[model samples]
Target: MGTGNNRTITKTRRKIRDVDQIKADLLCARHLEQFKDSKRPEDLPGLGQNYCIECAKWFDTETTLKAHKRGKPHKRRVKQLREEPEPDPRRIPGAQTTSQSIGQCYDTQSAHVAHMEVDT
Candidate 1:
């Protein structure tokens, strides 16, 4: 029982990390793809600064932009936005238990009499 429980926990952790990595990769790829397409020599679409790691955008003003990146509110918003919806645990495939069947007939005469009396 203990070994089975530990295996379940380890599997859950791996699954969680797999999901988080996919999300992070998705975000990173999205920005890189956009930046690759939108790149320009004279004027950048965002503001001409290197990719804002926090906002995932380019910025013009370094001081103000970096300040925004460093702010707690921005960090919180980024964190909130980065979080993907958790997978439904119920949907994950797992072993199913066999249901026991109670026969229609009573186990004994006394049990049947007791059940009938309770019903009455």
Candidate 2:
């Protein structure tokens, strides 16, 4: 059998945070690899620059978007998103209207689930 010291010295080791680094590297790599692969520059919509990570959409000015992306609140929100999953869709449907469903208890008055009225 091989000696313990020699075996330990010969063993291969990998970086503890290598996976995270690899993912980040891959994300960064995409911009270079994908950009070159697609030669048609004009085909890209809003091709001049990038959008802010915070805004997740286009920005009129690159400098303005960069400033917003660097803000503390934006970073904090990004961190929060990484930690928590998105909320359930059923929890919030959409704009709520005044309506009463069956089995719902009413204390003062009863009204429909939604009501649209125009002012006179």
The per-prediction CA RMSD against the true structure, in angstroms, equals 24.1, 21.5
CA lDDT scores, all candidates in order? 0.50, 0.46
Tens-digit lDDT track of model 1 for 15-98:
422333333434456534554466673566344655555444555667767787888866875686567577467753564433
lDDT score, residue 56, model 1? 47
**Which regions of candidate 2 are displaced past 4 Å?**
1-48, 86-120
Question: Model 1 Cα displacement at 87 (Å)?
Answer: 1.4
Show the colliding residue pairs in model 2.
98-112, 98-113, 99-112, 99-113
Model 1: how far is 68 from its true place, Å?
A: 0.8
TM-score of 2: 0.29
